[model samples]
Target: MTDPSVVHAPAPAPDRIGRLGAGVRGLMQHAEEAAGLAQRPGLLQGLDPRAKVAGAFALILAAVATRSLLVLLALFVLATALAAASQISPARLARQVWIVVLGFTGMIALPALILVPGTPVLSLPFGLAITEQGLRAAAFLTGRSETTATLALALVLTTPWPQVLKALRCLGVPRAAVMILGMTHRYIFVLADLALDLFEARRSRLVGRLSPAEARRLATGIAGALFERALALSSEVHLAMIARGWRGEVHLIDDFRFRPRDGGALVLAAAILAGTVWAGSVWP
Candidate 1:
């Protein structure tokens, strides 16, 4: 009784390896998309990475220093608008970073919502009460966290990873820390590729279903194999670096120069920061 014009969806893959492969691929796709977006002609994409880095950190510090909800909300809105101007979808940007911001903030702020002494706003079943002061404190804390995260995410999304690290070094970050960050970023992709290849190879050889014990055995095997592979790869990478005459220090070609446009950007950043600080003083 199936209609010839209608098509049915394929059955879901039953193997956990297959699902894991799909998940890895999805993550890789998102990373690639974000990198691609960085290359696109946009407001922040054209700016100097060093300026962007300084400006982003400046805004984040201001957000953390202030307790005024209005200032925090304004900063969040400013970040959203900047994303839009950069041709990045605000909703998509929020999706990528909001979980980290909201989830962590909620966990830390939730205690404040009931524990702090203030006028009772709501009475709960277990003799717990939400106070107005507690609610206000929670809102302020949450807003600050979200605003800081938003600004940080926007900077990362708009700048290339290499440029970001380089900018960090230019901004006086420790060479060891920058080197570690560079290697970590590089190895993340290497590990992801290794994982996807192994998972796909297993998936291709897998039959319809694996027994529970068989699946567990395969999972253990994959984990051990990947660990071994990582160690081997790290050794090879270190050897190659040494072969290239790498010393204890890393050097990147410094191309960042503070131009007139960058100066203008810095002025704007300072103005925003001043406003935020002043708002905190006036409001508090």
Candidate 2:
């Protein structure tokens, strides 16, 4: 005799659960790696975040101002050297910075190769031709993007998030902007963890593989629930922060001092920028 009270549920799908687990673990591992990198006793890591932020900005400006491909290449090399000095692996930079910048910039530059007018370098079907001017323009665009991204990534990887935010505040960025950036950064991780929890709970409760329509509905529901939870969490967090007397100002245990090394780094960055500008002007 079958028990009327008993309910049968289908077995859970292994693949879906495995993918969710892997994605969450990968994200957490990446965050941990970034934190570890910032703590390393490397050249950039030792310098004050203020100096690093300034230097990175100067380098990025140099990249943007330079028209010569050679100058951009030089900046990219300098960025790579700085990354090496900061104990950041080339593979990590390639995976995190280079690949992303190149992929995005490449798509934008591809159309320019056929659209811009100049001496024809290559002919293609559909009355398309790659021109010298177009090729140069595309190279310039892609190289500049890659150089700037490298410099920015180096700064981010070497500096802790809190210190970076504090450095921005010290550099005369508006207090409101700094506060927003800090809160956003902190909340991102908090929300990520919350999302992971939600996914896990859903996975546990899931009985079997969902049909395409069922999957879409489930995803939509999850998204709506996540948004609602995030709103409530933000409110509670704001109240808790107020209770703890957190004003709009950011504070850290170690106050930044402009050491001699930081001064030297700033000087070096200025010299590099000057040299790059000169090279760009003289390049035929």
Candidate 3:
């Protein structure tokens, strides 16, 4: 006896819950991909973690110390080459590192074009002008940011997190600092998974889209519940660690060995850093 002419409304989309779950899943996938990259038979992956860490540090220092745009470009090219040798896809680099850094740095550099006082390159309305000095400054800033990020990302992608932590410890980093970093990295995934589960449960229980007030209340309640659960989990983890006789030290199965290739890599990095400094000082 239902009327055939009656119109029906579409269901409301679970925008907030869906987006949160998707973001969490994306993070989890990114972490897994990074771990898989570390296991690949690539140039940086084959080197000792300590050597890789040192080399990355040297390259970063070179990037920071150089004032020449050409030098920064060279460093960026070198980083890209290293990434390729390490089996990283150019599209991945463009998507993850280059585009992100360029976008962020571009925003910061945009104002410099009109603010810097020099020979005017282009004139804008309201007596504003883009100067050669400003253009150079912006390019230098953007190039330096991009180069540094590329080098850092290359290191992170090719080295396992545990090995990187061990390398840091071996390189005279404070024990407490390393411990804190290790704990933070470990628990991030745990918290993400818990959040995803909570989101899923909430989504399943909902009959329709939440009102503004209802959504606020739900978010507040979820935040409180997550905080409580995180604290409880931390306590349980600490107690378990203590019960297992952990005395503020991390042990890994893979002991580091400095092979010939590792030594050569370190020396090459040092040489490049030295050359970059010399070139930067002498370049007009």
Say which candidate scores most in TM-score. Answer: 3
- Tens digits of lDDT, candidate 1, 69-119: 888888888888888889888688668777778888899999998999999
Compared with the true structure, all predictions reach lDDT values of 0.85, 0.88, 0.91
Instruction: Order the candidates by TM-score, highest first.
Output: 3, 2, 1
Q: Runs in model 2 with CA error above 4 Å?
A: 1-18
Give, for candidate 2, the lowest lDDT window spanning 10 residues: 12-21
Looking at model 3, report the run of 10 residues with the lowest lDDT sum: 11-20
Candidate 3: tens digits of C-alpha lDDT, residues 1-284: 87889977887775776787899999999999999999999999999999999999999999989978888889999999999999998899999989999999999999999898999989999999999999998998898888889888999999988889889989999989988988899889989999999989999899877887888888788889989999999999889988998765667986889999999999999999999999998883
- The whole-model C-alpha lDDT of candidate 3 against the native structure comes to 0.91
TM per candidate: 0.91, 0.91, 0.92
Query: Candidate 3, which segments miss by more than 4 Å at Cα?
Result: 1-14
Query: Residue 173 deviation, candidate 2, in Å?
Result: 0.8
